[model samples]
Target: MRDLLPPGVHVAESFGDPPGAVLLPEEEPAVARAVDRRRREYTTVRHLARRALRCLGHGAAALPPGEDRAPRWPTGVVGALTHCDGYRAAAVADATVVASVGIDAEPHEALPEEALGGVALPEEREHLARLDAAHPEFRWDRLLFSAKESVYKAWYPVTGAWLGFEQAVLTFDPAGSFRARVLPEAVVPGGPVVFDGRWCVTRSFVTTAVVVTRPDAAPPAPCGCPAR
Candidate 1:
């Protein structure tokens, strides 16, 4: 793999696979002056993401309504969407082959350790603390946040079971990338699937990416986790 990226990956990866393209709302200064500042940025990300999906031979048929919401791409296809201050990105693949996919990006900064109590499970908090103890300079908070997000994106598609943040604990190696196992060792109905993911941070931005494959399409192998 090249820098954690694979060869012969989806052609979409060519446009910056984990694509983040922007069509700014800079032209709407008048509308910007009238509406909440948020509407402008939101409009821009949606516009750019839609156009990008269209170029992929999927078009608006591959999009969801809310920018923060997941897309309603073609059946048997999985989709992931992400947005940051000035950019937004999305990914699409066969859903059956890919169990569930989740992608998240956030600015590189220490999230308030004290404030996330409601969302972070006790084991999750401790795991993050251990990671911090091991790597003082690395921002472990981003890892925890991204893990929860990956869990959400992956969970919804498989179990169709909505889970609270504390419902699962994310175990990562060193990067924000990791695997998720739901608590109490409960069966996921269809699977206790392998959640494969990757992430990166540069300058002031941090992003985490994940794609959980359904075992039905790519049956659970003895070796485990062959990334797409």
Candidate 2:
């Protein structure tokens, strides 16, 4: 997941349940009625989020969900979180350097046939078919879904609007990257917005991330150092 992001963006990931995970006082209400599995995932991800925040020099703090269910990050910070069966991750950056960040992870398996129509644009489906034919080892459909998830995560923070599944057209490169062309209908003031992102496939999961740097920010350092 770290490879999917750029410099100055702190990312943390956990596989399976995290030991000693507990909900902060402010975070408890959000999952008060959730099942055990839901509670564990939520708690584990927030725990990683605070750890990432501390890496940015912030104190550990509660990350309750906003009205829209997105984690309400502390002031001066921008981030995104994702959780799947056995994997959980959080990525954060100082708002001064990064405009927004989005990430997602899914099991490396084919998306259900019934969900293909809802998740992929017609042209995207055609592209996936061609890719699958050439590289049967990868699940193109699942990767497409994960990419779109990352796009939406990156979009909402900037636009403050919902981006539907069909709102973006995506194309992938076999070389570990993707491009999402946000359709004009999605309503960004500047019309269409194109997001370039990277993807990775491991033995267990397929992950994708999109990071938008602030136009006025200085270049990041060579290492994965957090922004000053």
Candidate 3:
């Protein structure tokens, strides 16, 4: 999984844990209105984020939520976190060396058919159709959805602007990777940037990530399977 990320980004991960009774001092208030399961998932991922931060030479500190509800990392750090069912993970990077990152994980199962209408663009659907024709085994539609998610994650921090699924065009390859181009209409920093990302299918889940260090750096090559 680390190989798929760009330089400077570090990841931390953990399996499911039963809901605990206490929240770290900084995490308590944010979860005051959350239900038990949401609270448990939130704490577990933050815990993973802290561990990853430490690995990057950062001290453990409360990661608060920003107005848009994204994690507010300590000054000089940019990162993202994700969790699904039994898994949880976090990735962090120095702000100086890397601009932003976005990571996501989903069950290997196919995305529900009905939701595709909202998750895919007409061009993306055509792209998925081609992927489906060429490689019938994997769920290309779901993979496209995941790719868009990673694109959005990396994008929001850079611009703090909303990017609908239709606003970006995504294409995938046979090697478990993807590329995303933001439409010109979207007000991204320094204009639209192409994002190259890697994805892998493990025994339990499909994970994807996008790492951005410079607005003009060339996109990295796609990486292969079993991420995590």
Looking at model 3, the pairs that clash are: none
lDDT of 1 by residue, 1-228 (tens): 112222212212211222343333432432355454354444444454454345334544523343334445555556665665644554555544565667666666888857577667777778878988998776777766865775677667667666777677777778445777677664466655455567676656656666665446644323112222
Q: Which candidate number has the best TM-score?
A: 2
Error of 1 at 85 (Å): 2.2
What's the lDDT for candidate 2? 0.88
Highest lDDT: which candidate?
2
On a 0 to 100 scale, what is the lDDT of residue 30 in model 3?
Answer: 91
Q: Estimate TM-scores for all models.
A: 0.70, 0.95, 0.88
lDDT of each: 0.55, 0.88, 0.78
Tens-digit per-residue lDDT, 100-209, candidate 2: 99999999988999898899989999999999999888899999999999999998998888899899999999999999998877777943399999999995899999
Model 2 lDDT, residue 19, Cα: 84
1-228 per-residue lDDT for model 3 (tens digits): 565676456776776753542457877889989997888889888877777778556646788788888988888889998888888888887787678898988877789888899999888889889889998878787778777888899998888789998888888878877889888888665744788899987856778999888656455333221222
Summing lDDT over every window of 10 consecutive residues in candidate 1, give the lowest-scoring window: 7-16
RMSD of 2: 2.1
lDDT for residue 167 in candidate 1, whole number 0-100: 72
**lDDT at 49 for candidate 1?**
44
Ranking by lDDT: 2, 3, 1
